[model samples]
Target: MKFCLKHGRCNCVEFYQGDLAAQADAPYILEADYKTWLDVIAGKLQPIPAMVLGKIKVKKGSFSVLAQYVTASLAMIKAAQKVGIQ
Candidate 1:
């Protein structure tokens, strides 16, 4: 899945879910283990806090760039929770 989040605006964000091979490219990609991702989508963990605990890693892009989208990032998490992953 690919989620495009704009600054402080969750409503305008774009999300896509499908085969990995068909997914669109994103400049920044947040990487975590399957369990960690599930925990996040289930609202059992928070991304930033997880990163602080070394549970999540930014496999692409810089921290500074990702930091600029914190609000949108959280918004993405909230949206993911609603997807009924659990």
Candidate 2:
């Protein structure tokens, strides 16, 4: 059941948490919306620990490649925050 903050409307939804089968009777939600919600819940807990922090030897190149990972991570964080997650 989904609770509508506007009014005391408690939607008796058949969905359980994030189950698709339960959401079958619910309205169609966008994929982006789902992803953000998941990320927020995940963020509330501890981050993933690195199994191994071995720095692999890389070929001689500029350090710009590291920038790509940083940018993508920031974008993901922003998108997650856009949703009601934290």
Candidate 3:
């Protein structure tokens, strides 16, 4: 995921099978403002809904291909929740 913190400055975080890395070139990139990401991570927003609403944008890969990983995506969110965010 590439988070657009502000302006055009962005940071990328990569996740693979529930593991996370500080940076990596992922096949699929999801881009959105920092606040939008916060909302999603905080469980205030659903990723799919956010994407549909345009709060999130796909910067790389195809949506159809990404959709195949919905389960993994949700699992990532769940794991993040378990780790908590501060």
Candidate 4:
């Protein structure tokens, strides 16, 4: 699955549930196991730590972009918490 958080908004702008090859191009592609994502959304794991711990994976993207979007990314995570994914 692919989730695109657009324009630095908390709301999910789009998502693709099929093979990534069929999805629209994105600057970043974050890949992780279900539990890893749950922990992130639940605030049990910070992204940096998770990355250091090898929980989260970036299949595509540039760290520079991620650094620039850090604030927006965190806000997006906080927004995801409202979805009750766990």
Candidate 5:
């Protein structure tokens, strides 16, 4: 999955297979405003709900396909929370 945080411009983060990178080709691309991403990473909001609520938009993939990896997705958020924004 690739996440593009839209803060005027888009800053992208990609999770492909088991690797994470600033940019990469991915089958799934999720996009949202910067604050929405911050909320997601902070655990203030959950990804699925955010998507259902339309706070997060899937720009390049299917939500049903992405939903199958809920555990991995949440794990990614947890991992991000651990590292935090420097």
Candidate 6:
């Protein structure tokens, strides 16, 4: 999971996918609620590890939830490649 999140993150993907409509970076986040994001972060969801618990706080909108995941995925991928998680 970690590997898929942050592999070669520098150019593999946009670290900041700023949204044009929102005019803010890290846009393209997710479409989930705060609790949903929390659940994913708190090990209440599958395909995710318990380590992500509470590392980040949920926001008022979907962007907040999605951004964390996007950024996390990038990091995970990087870490995976870093440590040869494969």
Q: What TM-score would each prediction reach against the true structure?
A: 0.65, 0.23, 0.67, 0.71, 0.71, 0.29
Off by over 4 Å in 2: 1-68
Q: Residue-wise lDDT of candidate 3 within 46-86, one digit each (tens)? A: 88878878898876678877777677667667766888878
Rank by TM-score (best first) = 5, 4, 3, 1, 6, 2
Worst 10 residues of 4 by lDDT: 9-18
By summed lDDT, the worst window of 10 consecutive residues in model 3 runs over 13-22
Report the Cα lDDT for residue 71, model 1: 72
Global lDDT for candidate 2?
A: 0.35
User: Where does model 6 exceed 4 Å of error?
Assistant: 1-21, 47-86
Q: How well does candidate 4 score on lDDT at residue 31?
A: 70
Off by over 4 Å in 5: 1-24
Candidates' RMSD to native = 4.0, 14.5, 10.1, 2.9, 9.6, 10.2
* Residue range 1-86, candidate 2, lDDT tens digits: 22222233333433344445345433322222444345434554211111012121212233345334444434544544566543
Range of the 10 consecutive residues with the lowest summed lDDT in candidate 2 = 45-54
lDDT by residue for model 4 (8-56), tens: 4334455654365345577777677778878888888887667656686
Report the number of the highest-lDDT candidate.
5
Note the residue pairs that clash in candidate 2. none
Ranking by lDDT: 5, 4, 1, 3, 6, 2
Candidate 4 yields a Cα-based lDDT of: 0.68
Model-by-model lDDT, in order? Answer: 0.67, 0.35, 0.67, 0.68, 0.76, 0.39
